[model samples]
Target: MRGFGDAAVEEVPDPVAGPGEAVVDVACVQPSVTECMLLAGEPIAMHTVLAARLAEGPVRFGGHEFAGVVRALGPGAPDGIRVGDRVTAVETAPCGRCAACRASHPHACPSPAVLGFTGPGAFAEQVLVPARTLVRVPDGVTAAQAAAIQPLAGALHGHAAAAVHPGDSVLIIGAGVMGVLHTQVARHGNAGLVMVSGRSEAKRELAGRAGADLVMDAVGDVEAAVLAATGGVGADVVFEAAGAGTFELAARCVRRGGTIVMVSVLPDHAGAPLARLRERGITVVHPRSGGGVFEHALRLVARGDVDVDCLISHRLAGVEALPEALAITRDKQRYGALGPAQVDLFDWDRAA
Candidate 1:
């Protein structure tokens, strides 16, 4: 993105694999709606930082969730990573040489390289990634499935952070891709009752099909329904995946001493229900991305435990379709998109 609300495909130099890095020939990529909001320069903390950097010059923007073939290995790249191997890479990794790493606090590393946001992402035909971040695509997992795994990994992280026990009631405050993924995770973990709240009937239906025990109309009395379903005690865990204003709802719906996992990135000034949370002794958990969740997510998708196919709502062909695909991703509500807009980099011959 060149500036706020600006996105385009332009000729740029192909990236070279630096030491410890590898270049990937992207087979496919999924455009994130959250990244689209960031490209438009929303005041969200991370996006604000990115926008400041963009003020200096054009940056290769987006395509964090992608899958591809290994094109070349840089000096000292793992011998196991060979050309033509299918893989997907983690988008962000802490710089191991940072002070935080020396202190055994890698998560607090002052300088983290975030693909698509902090550096050139996979929006183009090729992208450079740290070779260490690459995970081989397991047999039977399609390129599209691999491309969509990052967020699934994120959902996994959120589920783990919630620390839900067996027979717990789970309330998800949105029925978008992340919400439904959370629903599936909860169901697989043996949650007693899994409920989803969504504004659109289509998303509600999708959530039900994705294993939600009850789909509550987000526009209606969601809290009442959730409380009623749980014998007026409320859910044991609430996942606030809907972004911004939904945090208040999650806070309100969680049982006393229950957990509310903040899954969405929010703007700096989104109001918090501190008083209510404190009074109820609700535990709020914020899980960051990383630490091998990608590997676990791939295994789940490969084993058919998490159905990524249900999340994908649209598929377009080739890099040329990138602009239109991004537009569709940005207007997800209009498109009824439960997941990111997908673009196929391969199979153009068949597409043609």
Candidate 2:
């Protein structure tokens, strides 16, 4: 991004492997909706904090969800990491030399370089990532599918914090990729009743296919519908995957003593139903994105337990389409995009 709300493709130097890092020949990349919002200089927390630095320079941002073959490995890279390995990596890499790392509390690391947003990302033909974050893509998963697995890994991290158990009820707000993934994950956990709320009929239909027992139009009284579905009780767990605006609905739909897992990164000023949450003694949680969840997510995808292909609505070729793809993700409703628009940097079929 050149400045707030201005983005265009310009030729940038191709990334090269640095010590302890590797250069991935990006096969495919999918830009998250949040990335598009941030790139547009929305008043999201991330942009707000980085506004000054961004204003000082042209930044290469977005494309944390991607997969590719290892093109080059720098010296000191771990054993078993080699060129030609197909991999998808975790976006957030913790700084292991910090006080938090010394204390064995790596999650509290004060400074972590968020790939794409903080540094160069996978929006181009190659991206440099910490070798430690790489997760091998299984044989059967396509590059496009591997590119899309990062978000599923994030969903799995949230599900772990939700502490979902068999016979528990789940309500997911926003039938987007995370919502649908949560729906499928909840079902896999044998949740008694799984519900999803979406503003679009198409998304609702997709939610049903993802194993949501009930799909409610988000414009209507979602809390009432959730209550009705639970026989006067609210959902045992509510997933706020729809971003900041849906926090209130998540609060209202969750039963007293139930948990609310916030998967989306909301803005600093985003409204929350704190009073109601306090009154109900609701446990609100924001899950961190680690714990080997990517491995579990990969297994699920490889085993066909989660259906990612159906959520992909647009697939564009080459990095040149990134600008238009970002716009499509921004105007998702207009474009009928269920998830981030996938951009293929290299021909996966040809590689296969």
Candidate 3:
């Protein structure tokens, strides 16, 4: 296996799917999270990463969050999935026979081959995936929208478990993608107030567009700002999305009986201010994957209930533009990529 920070574009022959598989001309690539890991010299680092390419006929391409349309369907796949059908894909290649899968816990199967993180991914022109792996993109949905939905589903998993009640106020730490989704879900659940705390104004703007009512720049007295939003009552729910010194801010923002939802990966040493929670009788909501969360996320988009399109800030196509498009995220244009647009990966690949 290669060392971390060693991810480079290594070309392989065009793949042809065998029976029970489908070949999707990747229509879009969702960036941000995966690129963060790769930039840190950990090309293979991921939440649900598969082992590296072993004997190597079809090597890996590091894009797990993706969407596309089936260009060709292999034998044995149902005819309902025609060539022109648009779809989004996930990383879990579960063995349906496994105990975990039988219990609807495929994401946590002992052995799973995910799309880009673990297996061949959708970053390229054509991604070969099992027929069962793809989720049909609903009508009027763009590829970028679908691509973004996958992560939103993961975020929703935690939020749903927390069960934000109507008239409850929500406090979200970090205006990153996860934080944005948390705010959206909180609003959809009829939260009394949606407050987001983040470092950058740009992220705050994004959060607002995604339905946050009040935005707080957490550089100073974030905890106070949150309390003020609730008239000193504190928030009914808090989400630690930033995983920085945010636990204190989050813990302090919640009311006596409020709940805290941990949506993203936090450091091992990043301890929560548990004494506050214990004293307040606050519950910590920890949600796992599965539960057909993505399917629910798609339906939310289809209904136009969740304004996910507001969160997409950038869209780039083809291999040539990838390098520069990738750079904008780090420089002045980070998150400046605005207004959700459909990503057509097939067009980019064929053009390249």
Candidate 4:
């Protein structure tokens, strides 16, 4: 993005791979809700860094959730990845020298290089990425599906954090992209009852299609409905994906000693029922990133276990449509979008 809330298609030199890096020809790229929020100058965690970059000049801002073919590899690139391979990458690359990495906890690394944020992203025709982050796209998974797998990986991570057990009741707030994905994941992961709450009728229906046993309007008494469904106990695990101002609802809907996974990119100091949560001994989990689940998520998509294609609502052609795609993703309800907006930059299937 050139500046906060500004994006355009402009000519720029093609990226060349540096040592330990690879250049991928982008086939499909999707704009995420988080990216749209960040671009619109939302004071999320990365706002300051983006502001600094804007002061310097126009930045190549987005396209982390993308799938493409490896075009070139530089010296010291990983051995297994080859040019022309269909691939998607984990956005976070931890510094191997950090204490977290030395302890085999790369996900906790304090210093990590984030694709599309720390460097130029895949919004253009080509993007440079660390070779180590590359994950091969399987045969059955389309470029669009691969481009959208990052969020599914995130959903998997959130589900794992909840430590769901068979026959447990699960509740998801916000039937947006993450909410539907979480619903599917929960249903497939052995949850006995899956409940979803959202403001949009269409999104609530989408959640039901994705395996939500019960769908409630967020504008209603969601807490009461959840309690009624759970036999006055409340959900065993709740995923709060509706951003700020919903933590209290999640707290109210979750059973005592249950888990609440904060899937949304919340503001620095979002209000919560802190005392209630503490008194109830609730385990609140904030899944940091979808670092290690890309391969598993891709496998699920390839095996038709997860339906990523059904969630895609808008597919615009060419990089020129990026601004429009971002707009739709930013205001999905206004645009009647069911999921993130995707832009196809190349005909990867035809080429293959």
Best by lDDT: 4
lDDT of each: 0.87, 0.87, 0.71, 0.91
Across residues 145-248, which tens digit of lDDT does each residue of candidate 4 receive?
Answer: 99999999999999988899999999999999899999999989979999999998988988999989999999999999999999999999999999899988
**How close is every model to the real structure, measured as TM-score?**
0.96, 0.97, 0.83, 0.97
Stretches off by above 4 angstroms in model 2 are: none
Q: Which stretches of candidate 4 lie over 4 Å from their true place?
A: none
Q: By TM-score, is 1 or 2 better? A: 2
Clashing pairs in 2: none
Residue-by-residue lDDT tens digits, candidate 2, 249-270: 8888899999999987788688
The CA root-mean-square deviation of candidate 4, after full C-alpha superposition on the true structure, stands at: 1.2
Select the stronger candidate by lDDT from 1 and 3: 1
Q: How do the residues 242-346 of candidate 3 rate in per-residue lDDT, one tens digit apiece? A: 854777777788999988887656544566777778999998877765426777899998888786777666666674444444455434234465423224445
Worst window of 10 by summed lDDT in candidate 2: 47-56
Q: Candidates 1 and 4: which is better by TM-score?
A: 4
- Over all chains combined, what TM-score does candidate 4 have? 0.97
RMSD of each candidate relative to the true structure: 2.0, 1.4, 4.0, 1.2
Query: Model 4, residue 115: what's the lDDT?
Result: 89
Which 10-residue span in candidate 1 carries the lowest summed lDDT?
343-352
